[model samples]
Target: MSAELRRELSRLDTLANALDSQFRIPGIGMRIGWDGILGLVPGVGDAVTLLPAAYLLYKGHRLGARRMTLMQMALNSGIDLAIGAVPLLGDLFDIGFKANKRNVALLRRDIEARIEEVA
Candidate 1:
């Protein structure tokens, strides 16, 4: 991958991870971000949070992240969004569940695994 692409993906991962961090989970809260406040507004916060994943999924598809891999990432987003739509449950789930973070991890792992295969 080119330096620019790496930087872009890194930034996206940071943002996604931040969204996942608003919770108090151990080993996860370090990435906490403003999703709590921003997400208070209806329709916008969730949309903002999901956008990065959508972009990443599109990019991943273009970059040839396998169909199943891409589906898993998409499924993560779907689950997050679905659960996040609930009243109190969504908020709690948002803080506890780090779908974006998980997706980033998945992507990174895929990258690493491919690299290993080459070696």
Candidate 2:
């Protein structure tokens, strides 16, 4: 991959990691991140998190991701936003869903595929 693409991917990876699984549970070996924390705020929290997720989707589009790939990314984010709007259940859902992480993974895979095609 080009340096610019690598850099962008790295940045998105960092952001997704921080937002999805930066914190570890004390004993269960589980992890959660800012998404979980912010999700505690109810309606606004899930909405706020969607911004980054949407950005990732947009990045995927700009990078030439296939329509199906973009749709899957959107589906992931939509599921997260929909279920994440609930009360206690939503916070729990956010902890496990990791929509941003999933979106980045999709983006990374799409970029790698493009690189392979170019090669």
Residue 71's lDDT in candidate 2: 96
Clashes of 2: 0
Tens digits of per-residue lDDT for model 2 on 84-106? Answer: 88999988998888999998998
Best by TM-score: 2
Model 1 collision count: 0
Q: Which stretches in model 1 have alpha-carbon errors above 4 Å?
A: 1-9, 22-31, 34-36
Q: Tell me the tens digit of each residue's lDDT in model 1 across 76-96.
A: 889877777776767667666
The stretch of ten residues in a row with the least summed lDDT in candidate 2 is: 106-115
Candidate 1 residue pairs that clash: none
Runs in model 2 with CA error above 4 Å? none
TM-score for all models, in order of appearance: 0.75, 0.93
